[model samples]
Target: MAPTPCITVDHLTVNYRDVQALRNIRLTVQPGKVVGIFGPNGAGKSTLIKAMLGLMPVVTGRVSYGEGTLARQLDRVAYVPQRSQIDWTFPATVWDVVMMGRVKKTGWFNRFSAVSRRLATEALERVGMLEFRDRPIGALSGGQQQRVFLARALAQQAEIFFFDEPFVGVDQKTEAVLFKIFQELAAAGSIVMVVNHDLGESITHFDQLILLNKELIAAGPRDRVLTRDNMTRAYGGHVGFFGHVA
Candidate 1:
């Protein structure tokens, strides 16, 4: 079999009202790698992914997956937004949330198939949330909530995964579980991209890095993109390497 086609962003640009959020961004996301988007506050890390997925309006350029644009293949993409963006008290059970992932496949106004239910159950079990399936989403801890969302994504069985700030506020155990699953997904030939703000040890988990500061600072393997000069350009100062400050 031939290699899977990579996701490509060509001369992408996005603006928010009068403010430019991202400018002339270009990158290729290959299958079977965990690519991290890193930057300072308001550096457009989230904006870039959203634009690539066509969740946000792009002022210029385009994002293509294989030979097709992302907008045309959204069913193959799974996105988990920041925890802060979700309403915890939405009167939904954990099972309800996870099953939502099947909506695209199940079709509107159609009941989920038995296979879809089985997939959702397996996803919850993988994330260790099966026992709490009937519990309200609001009753879960921060880590539990994140795990539930992850389960939802897994149930989607999407080829491309986009996670925005998945590590923020999650417990250490959740972080470990999440990274393990991410590695598994990459190993299985999926595209995984994470938008992360932490400039600490967790940065080591990514195979590739896309450093941004309202524009493309650098994009490559972690070692090549995490250089001192790139860090200074993206963050406007020196950042600690590994676990030590410069």
Candidate 2:
């Protein structure tokens, strides 16, 4: 595999109006791995990703990819915001939502090329949502909806993928599908970051873990980050659900 630029977060801080959310976060995330951001509620796990993507207001810090800032190279990024943030009532078909991924390259109001259609179709097929392509996105089950979004992200063919709470309402099958594709992306040298809350066996799927609680706690290999001390610092109590930790 060729060398690729790792994601660098330096002295990152975020404030929500008058309240500070994250402070002085610093980490380096390499490609070729599925990185999980784990923390208790209001711990700023999602804030970190949003700050890195420039979606949240950052008071200090820089997220760099290679020689340039990540915000400046967004075309190479794929993001799936939390499900609650999405408007489920939106009247868009599964195919329409998947095709939207090509908008950045195909441009708005322009016809999509055959290649774009092929990519979108293949993405849907990979996610097992091809048969539901014509169904309304709002009408699908929670797992089905999540699969469609995954397909949409796949259609974008991005080098960096950020998922916020993807498994919240998904079924076992959806979770399995997600991890399978995430491993594939990492194997292909793409950066895959997921914001997850579960501390069960599912935690073992991540190659690296980022633990936070309004600030950085630990980050590195799963075993290193999920140490008893690290877990206590991040969760403020004994974590009993994650079986893989020491």
Candidate 3:
């Protein structure tokens, strides 16, 4: 079995020019759980992950995975950004996109080995996109495109998975499949973190929640972190709960 990995963010802050995106955020993410990052639009949900991964400039604090800093251990992480961040007209086939996951392992100027090819193939099949392997990415529907990206992340076989708004524009079937895979990854001692804006039934899928409003509002088990007060504070007093708010 693989060793469990954990993420620690200490006094993290992010800024874009003169605007502050995240402020003095702190949290610890344990392994073997599906953690959700939730908040209103522009509440810095995406900014948190990007700052942790060092994709954006940070004004303060640091993110560490296990005993090492995240910047030094990025190869162990797999990140799937929001779908809107991708260019659908990039002129790549579904297979090409998935195989790109292996590029880091395969190295520059090196051809993909048989093992890399097999991993990519298995990832595509797991996401039910093997038949569309040769199809141009632009030809697929929104849900299919999302699945292809999921397959890409799966192919990377990283210990930490960060997904930003994966459920957006996806079909119910795709959503079900994505959550099933996330649960499996967590069960296997991988750290799975998802960024989501919805407060509905889909929120139940997370085992842990990190509620944010440009700062850390609450962080704990789903039920504890989704309290009425935290919801009101994070969503500006407009959140309604039905059936215990999951």
Candidate 4:
């Protein structure tokens, strides 16, 4: 039997008014896999995730989840946007922010019940931010803020997870913690897609790689997809643009 794909994106194209962000992107990811999206700047890495979550306007093609589609199953998906996009100065407690994930399931105008609060606290604990539940979100460091956002996503309890630059400014220890949580999510048969920029670490961390440069460059196991040829192809003569990190 063919493995069930948690996500199937077929010949999808995304446009941002005058700019064509993503072009003819076809991808299928099985459940329980940690897929990494990589390329240099303007590669449409975040655009792809936004398209899948129905946050970006698609000029053409289809994006489906299982046999249905993303639009019909929005509640089953969780999105963690890049930390830089959020307004951290907003008046919100750590617990308040995490509880917001439950808003979709519990509808607006409804207060979070005990069960929702418990789940939110547990997620905070899982990400090592439980101690700061009552603290103001703006008071936390960059890494802590990221973890709070992740805990919020976790509180969503969705089957498919999409994280955009979750490791952007986090420390190695925090990155490891997030990776372990990702592994646990996949182990429980949930798909975890991370939009990442650390090219060197991509080879060692992800189960599968999705290379993009305004088009589908390659999609397969990390070892097969991260070769020098594909690297050069996706990066296009700029493979050595950044110093290699040991």
Clashing pairs in 3: none
Residue 38's lDDT in candidate 2: 93
Per-residue C-alpha lDDT of model 3 across residues 1-25, encoded as one tens digit per residue: 6597678999998999988999999
Quote the lDDT for 191 in model 1.
Answer: 92
Q: Which of the predicted structures, 2 or 4, would earn the higher lDDT when compared with the native?
A: 2
Which model is ahead, 3 or 4, in terms of lDDT? 3
Prediction RMSDs, each to the true structure: 1.5, 1.5, 1.6, 2.9
Which runs of model 4 end up more than 4 angstroms from their true locations? 1-5, 109-111, 238-246
Ranked by lDDT from best down, the candidates are: 2, 1, 3, 4
Q: Please state the error at residue 213 of candidate 3 in Å.
A: 0.5
- Kindly list the per-residue Cα lDDT of model 4 for residues 80-160, writing each as its tens digit: 888778898899999999999999767766537887888998999999999999999999987898899889889988888
The parts of candidate 1 lying over 4 Å away from their true place are: 1-3, 109-111, 243-245
Candidate 2, 1-246: lDDT as tens digits: 456689999999999998899999999999999999999999998888888998867999999999999998888899999999999999999999998988965677642788889999999999999999999999999989989999989999889999999998889999999999999999999999999999888999999999999989999999888788888898887776576434
* Worst window of 10 by summed lDDT in candidate 1: 237-246
TM-score of 1: 0.96
* Clash totals for all candidate models: 0, 0, 0, 0
Superior candidate under TM-score, 3 versus 4: 3
In TM-score terms, candidate 2 sits at: 0.96
Cα lDDT, all candidates = 0.90, 0.91, 0.89, 0.85
How well does candidate 3 score on lDDT at residue 34? 95
Candidate 4 clashing pairs?
Answer: none
lDDT of 3: 0.89
Error of 4 at 79 (Å): 0.3
